[model samples]
Target: MSAGRAGAQIKSFEAWDYVVFAALFVISSGIGVFFAIKERKKVTSREFLVGGKQMNGGPVALSLTASFMSAVTVLGTPAEIYRFGAPFLLFFIPYTFVIIFTSELFLPVFYRSGITSTYEYLQLRFNKVVRFAATIIYIVQTILYTGVVIYAPALALNQVTGFDLWGSVFATGIVCTFYCTLGGLKAVVWTDAFQMVIMMIGFLTVLIQGTARAGGLRNALDQAKNGSRLEIFDFDVDPLRRHTFWTIAVGGTFTWLGIYGVNQSTIQRCISCKTEKHAKIALYLNLVGLWLILACAVFSGLIMYSYFKNCDPWTAGIISAPDQLMPYFVMEIFASMPGLPGLFVACAFSGTLSTVAASINALATVAFEDFVKSFFPNLSDRWSTWISKGLCVLFGILCTSMAVAASFMGSVVQASLSIHGMCGGPVLGLFTLGIVFPFVNWKGALGGLVTGITLSFWVTIGGFVFPAQAAKTHPLVLSTEQCVQLNMTETAPTTAPSVIVNRPALAETWYSLSYLYYSAVGCLGCLLAGLLISFITGPQKGKDVQPQLIRPVGNLFCFWSKKYKRLCWCGVQHDSETILDNLETDTAWKQGTGLDGLKDGQDHLPGYNPDEKSYTNLASEKVTHF
Candidate 1:
């Protein structure tokens, strides 16, 4: 009789959980649809992807938050905490500085240039080869990054609710594809704003509830400190130590500099803002939000330490994998809260979908504007928009498929970061060369980009291989799994700690050095190579180059000088200063008529007609610096 009663209770709980998950899914889907309809009219070509250059500061910042959050934050942060303690938080310090620098230094240049795609700047700075190389790197990186983001949430939801993982991934992808194809940047940004709110609520709820269950915030902190989970700084100089103060501070800054300064996803958001000032404000706001989120995530991890002190997930069989730690905690918290799990799922999906949509939209913009139009000269906005939409659908499907495949790869977080590190450096290098070193020729930029990517791959793969071999030959070196499992024991398990001392295997410290460093290295490599090649190839004459190509750089540095006194400084003969001054005064450039107004006046230069052709004609001019 007692057994029967217990079985009945279990069945009832299971049924209730199903109801909650289902209701949450339906409501979240409705929210997405509602936003899609609200932004339906703005779903035109350039506007759909770039938000028509009219997105406000708040929405842009929120969109950025959603993009950066991802399943990585929800799933990876807990897993990292479970393994490495609080030192991982140091990664964000450099990121904050990078955001400030990128906003102050890079945003104005992108805004002044008036280009939709960051790759367009490559062509202006160097040659088409650099642009093509950068675009390919971005496309590859986007697909991989988006795939992992999609996979993280799906993997978590699957373990918690027993949902079909691939099906969940496909469902999320299809929804994102439909809305992104229909609505563009506005839809993505607006939806992202809501998503960011949902994610914070979900995270905060878990933190508060877990802390309450663990006997309050003070107890949680006390327990974390006792267990050594509260250690936030590691000042060791060993390259193999993953979270050292120097590595995270110096290495992390370079990583974020590549991300904020050079990456397309980040730049696309900044460029979509209404004005340079608005973009700068959005970036600063994003920094604040990012710091808050990291703090919340770190606190959540500490709370987990208190709650799970008696029975760790890896040891108890509640979660077989480290990444499943966050989901397990979520399930335990929302077990009694009706409709909350659904909301959480929606938030997770929202983060994944917002990121996917942004990438797809950006990828489409790059493809149509950079690659397709180069070959097809007579493409219309309508046609180009359709092409981009079609590509979005195709890429969305491809990414979903990749997400399903990601399950076979061990450790989703590590794989994602590694992929980023491998490719990110080279792309960063190529862009840096174009922007900072004006004299680098196409050949040098191309060679440097290739060399940088190749070197990064060799170093990364070598690091992985050497560690694995050393671990097998000399059993003293601690493997990544062993390091992660160390905290699972009630008391720190007694093992020969000296086995890891000067062992041949790669240390956990070096694991953090993945592709995040790639961009900085690639940028340096490209600059040096480009300069060397330019020395060999010789410089182009000044008169042979177009003036508009260098206008933004000139304007930024010449702010206190009269070097760019003409509005038509780039041979358009319109006094650039006057046109820029008038736009600053009237803000007419926001309406797209600033250039059109210059068509019929003394502002117009011979053969520089806007209506005669698209901006690619400007690419023909040689780039020269005074």
Candidate 2:
């Protein structure tokens, strides 16, 4: 039911194409080597994880933009928009709100918390058990998905362009491992900045060429309009409707918040900034790059429609799967141009490099900060650095092994991917409960996390047991008039588009809800269950908890709960202090952002020297938190 190629062989790569592809690996590897030598870690592991808290806003912002963008976005977004209507483009409407929430509510807390792992906040607010559980959830989810991400795309690329399947997979995995192991976080962020440039150039090339071939932008729009693919508004109130305004916009906002609001990679990058103001500026700048890329994806979808308006390649059996459409189109159009196809391939691989590298780096940070350091608090700085490097190398190999395993799975990969996405809502719920609602205790948080994940998996598993009818989720009209097929002649377009219909039974209705709303469902479940449990078990006084852990929403709804005394909003305490804490008995390297928000007595810790600049020691010798 996916790609079913007709007869013609796909064009193979030329010499210039190989050169372009080779440069991507060389440039990427070079960045890692440069940083690894310049900022060699002789003391502790802090610099390896967060760039010594001295990274500039611009490069870090670019890295942030690249880290979240996977091959799925580069390959799948166009295919998604091409198959469905342009209403999918409305998903970005909520992405703006995602950035706002991360900057205002989440980023500040992580930036000042003095913790390396994002899950460290979970421990600080709730308990170590909660932190370990969340860390485990992240580890499992990231490893599984990362492997599938690298494998499936390599397989598809091989089928279309004669690229080496196992070779590309192993090469990508090892090269990423080499650089990340050698350079640490500085290498990851700098390489990401470089890779994103290649990615953007590739996107621009596709858009400009495709538009020119289709006559112009206006003509492309007209073609898209004729095929009923130019729609952006779908006001249908039905929950089962895919790509509706409610589902794509409202529901999507909630979905993205789970990622931008609390993902570990995102938190790590923001924490690397010199100041909170720099973090804010970098985040806002990141929106520009992200939105630009998405716009290309959506616009490129229209260009795909323009080229295949009458032919409908997938319908004509010229291509097998919707996901293969982009690869086919690239080879089909850019073959004669030589290096253009190579550039596109490099663009796709850039996505692979940035995403996997970032994941490996995060896994290393969390593994050491959450698991290793907790058990062995007395380790020397040199030993801690070695342990951290060893963890990075270990994760990189595990990820590669998982990629090898991915090649053996069939439809199970999709199911695994869906399960991977399901865990995010619960993770987001854990952070939201701790940061937004103070009355929710450790027990409430643990219970809510379990309840949310359970409900999410139940609904998702039910979906697999009884899949929806194909006709119910059909795409708009597509004609195959121009394609020269064996049996069919003329355009095949007699059938009307399928309309949304109500299911009869309760279970059927449950299964019918669109995947877009999954995050909302899980989040709401967690919040509601957590609130109920907190009230029954005697919620904590807002006054008892520190305000830095809580996001100050208003002078916030203090009157909403003080009368019942069920929940009370706390007031924030702000004092004047610039991070300059020195430890003589403890250790000190580059002073981290953790020392940023110290209070009256705590801010003025002993041996506070401002003239020292050393990377041979660590201040977190005890792994202390304020």
Highest TM-score: which candidate? 2
In model 1, how large is the Cα lDDT of residue 287? 84
Q: Once superposed on the true structure, which residue ranges of model 1 sit more than 4 Å away at CA?
A: 1-44, 380-386, 463-519, 539-579, 584-588, 591-626
- Please identify model 2 stretches exceeding 4 Å from their true place: 1-7, 41-43, 164-167, 379-390, 401-420, 486-507, 556-590, 593-626
Candidate 1 lDDT score relative to the true structure: 0.65
Q: Compared with the true structure, what per-residue lDDT tens digits does model 2 show for residues 504-583? A: 47445777666666777777788888878888888866655655567655434544554333333432232222233333
Best candidate according to lDDT = 2
What's the lDDT for candidate 2? 0.72
RMSD of 2: 6.0
Q: Per-residue lDDT tens digits of candidate 1, residues 1-626?
A: 00111111111125555575565545545665676677667645456556777778998988787787766787777667756578768867887788876876666556655566788877766777778888888888778777888888887777767777788788778876775665556667777777788789888878777887778899888877877777777676654455567767876776667767777888888877877778888998988878877888888877876666555655544456777777776666656775666555555666787788777777777877788889996988688767877888888887777786667554665667656766776776776655544455677778888887876676666555544332211111112221133335653445765554453433443433433444455556656676677678874333343333333345555677665533223332224212223223233345332131122222333334345422222322322110
TM-scores, all models, native as reference: 0.80, 0.85
Clashes of 2: 10
